[model samples]
Target: MKRWKIAGLFAMALMVSAAPFQAFATSPEFAYTAEKWASLRDNKLEYGEIADLIHEYNTTVRQNELDYQEYKGKTSTDIAEEYYDSANEVSERIRYPDDDSANYANQIASALNSEISVTNLTEQGDSNVDDGEIKRLGYEQQEKNLVQQAQKLMISYYSGKASLATLEDAVTQAETAYTQAQTRKAAGMALQSDLDTAAEAVTNAKASLQSAKSSLEQTKQQLIIMMGWNYNDSVEIGSLPDVDTSVVSKINVTSDIQTAIANNYSVKITERRLANSQSENNRATYTNTLANQKETVSTNVKNAYNSLVLAKDSYDQAKTSYDLAEKERAAAELRLSAGTITKKTYEKQESACLSAKTSMETAKLSFLTAQVTYDWAVAGLASVS
Candidate 1:
């Protein structure tokens, strides 16, 4: 009766031990969904977080690759981390066989298992684990890098000091118009047309404000999408710090144009794509003459260089126009307020001020576009080194 009671307790303990292993074997799968991805990105992720995730995933992939090589009867460069962890834990459980061991114990009733048996038991352990591995992402890295570059572009698009500077000058002009109208209304010294013109300037200012707001939101969305977020995902950016005026001032016609050609992300992309095209062309020509190939390459280089020069010249012109517009707008506003200008003249001044602001924004866009084009062109022709 005592033997049977011991058997019953042993069976109960076996079931209890096996239950956890069974549960672990059937662990739920790791899930990823669009909504969940959005939530995680919002709540737990940042730009740096993505970089860390890539690093960890790369490590796991390397481990898996080594294990795969080992399984294929090849020399692996590294051992599996899991293998080491398991070996350390299971070493304590292993005991050497003894010549005078008791025969009463069942074959499977030993307190510990041998190393070979343990390895066999755990051979399929990885099958049940959710490794959460992402595939080779070299191309994806380029895509991600481009997206990040795009975000920087969008920020510069909206929060540029050039645009802000132009807007401030316009605001001053509008305020001046308002003051002049008020003075004229009070003194009965202003024409009806003058009052009407002043009112129109205020309306234009409000319109300009709306335009800025719209552009800001659009650029913000562009940045969010570039960072690999859904269109509806909310992003709260910290305030933009003042861009280095020194850097801005350091941008000269010749040196900046040259630097932009080399460093602009867009230009680099274009350059890479063009080089890829050249390689494809070379590969396809099984019996082409060396001179012909050289000529073709030369032609491409010339076209790209010319394009860069044109872009640089356009940037220079835009900068001059923007500066001149700012000056003219400010002077016009001052003249209108001093009653030296008639209402019709004041309206013309308001128009000129708005035109200047618009010109400045356009110039900024042109400069960036050219800069990107030049960079991509250079990248096509040369390696990242």
Candidate 2:
């Protein structure tokens, strides 16, 4: 019965020691699997899906998530418990020692003392730092940054497409102008210098168009790759949702600053460290660090809010300009119908209208970006030092 009880205790100790390692092996927090990536390849990437996509596809963020999981799985307490359990098992065996009884007892005593020392050290370390929580917060911060980057890439890709449309129109207009200039010069109605200038404009416009096309392609490639697609893979990028400028009116800067300070990962980590600081010097240093981080978060949130306001103003101005451009283009169409404006002049007005439309689209995207930045700031992922 004694032997059976000892064996049972030893078995239970082994199981207890292995439990954390088993959990660590099975825990897959933020794990990115190949199947997940394969499934995403066929889906159209939208702005709203950027955060999830980044969490799965971004190498750095995925690695950080894994690191956090590993840290949490192998916590100091878990390790200390495992050591203590091992020492208990060895001490239990010492109770039924035979010819090497003294040897077994010495080993048991040594193991228990070592386990105690290890437990003390681990407890002291845990008291000084919340490593698991800090790592988890770090991973969260990284994911937020990657999400912002992916969003910016999406905005750039669409904005480039808009600019590409305007450039293509400009190229067509320039070519038509060059042909008309050539015709007028042949009839001696236009100066040779005028024809030369028109030819130069056509060359410049075509070069600009080509450059814009290349730039747009590069942006598309970046966005697709970030979305976990091969660089050569074909995927349709959906258009961004229309910006709602009214959100600016709902922003409360002072309230947002407080929220940012509370949510900010850096500020929170510093606070944790400050709480764990045992020495007066270390506590004071962390206190000052905490204050600086809070201040930085406050400033970042305020700046993001201000930027959103500016973006709103710019969008409003661009909308007004676009409205005016549309009216002028309408009048120019009538003038063309009445034979008062040449076809080239009317086309120039149309190009101007297209340019205005592109400006408005770009401004709207800028406002959206600012809105995202501000929202992220208030949520505790402010971009600051």
Give candidate 2 misplaced runs (Cα > 4 Å).
Answer: 1-41, 73-130, 188-197
Please estimate how well model 1 matches the true structure, expressed as its whole-model Cα lDDT.
0.47
lDDT of each: 0.47, 0.74
Q: How does residue 233 of candidate 2 score in lDDT?
A: 71
- As for model 1, its CA RMSD to the true structure in angstroms is 20.1
Off by over 4 Å in 1: 1-152, 155-161, 230-304, 310-369, 381-385
Instruction: Please write out the lDDT profile of model 1 over residues 1-71, one tens digit for every residue.
Output: 22223323533543454432211121111334565434434523343334322322222322333333223
lDDT per residue for candidate 2 within 33-108, as digits (tens), equals 6664444444578777687666555556534544554467444355445555665564454433354676887766
TM-score, each model? Answer: 0.38, 0.74
Give the C-alpha miss distance for residue 96 in model 1, angstroms: 76
Lowest summed lDDT over 10 consecutive residues: which window, candidate 2? 20-29
Clashing pairs in 1: 267-372, 267-375, 267-376, 267-377, 268-375, 268-376, 271-376, 271-380, 272-380
Among all windows of ten consecutive residues in candidate 1, which has the lowest summed lDDT?
A: 20-29
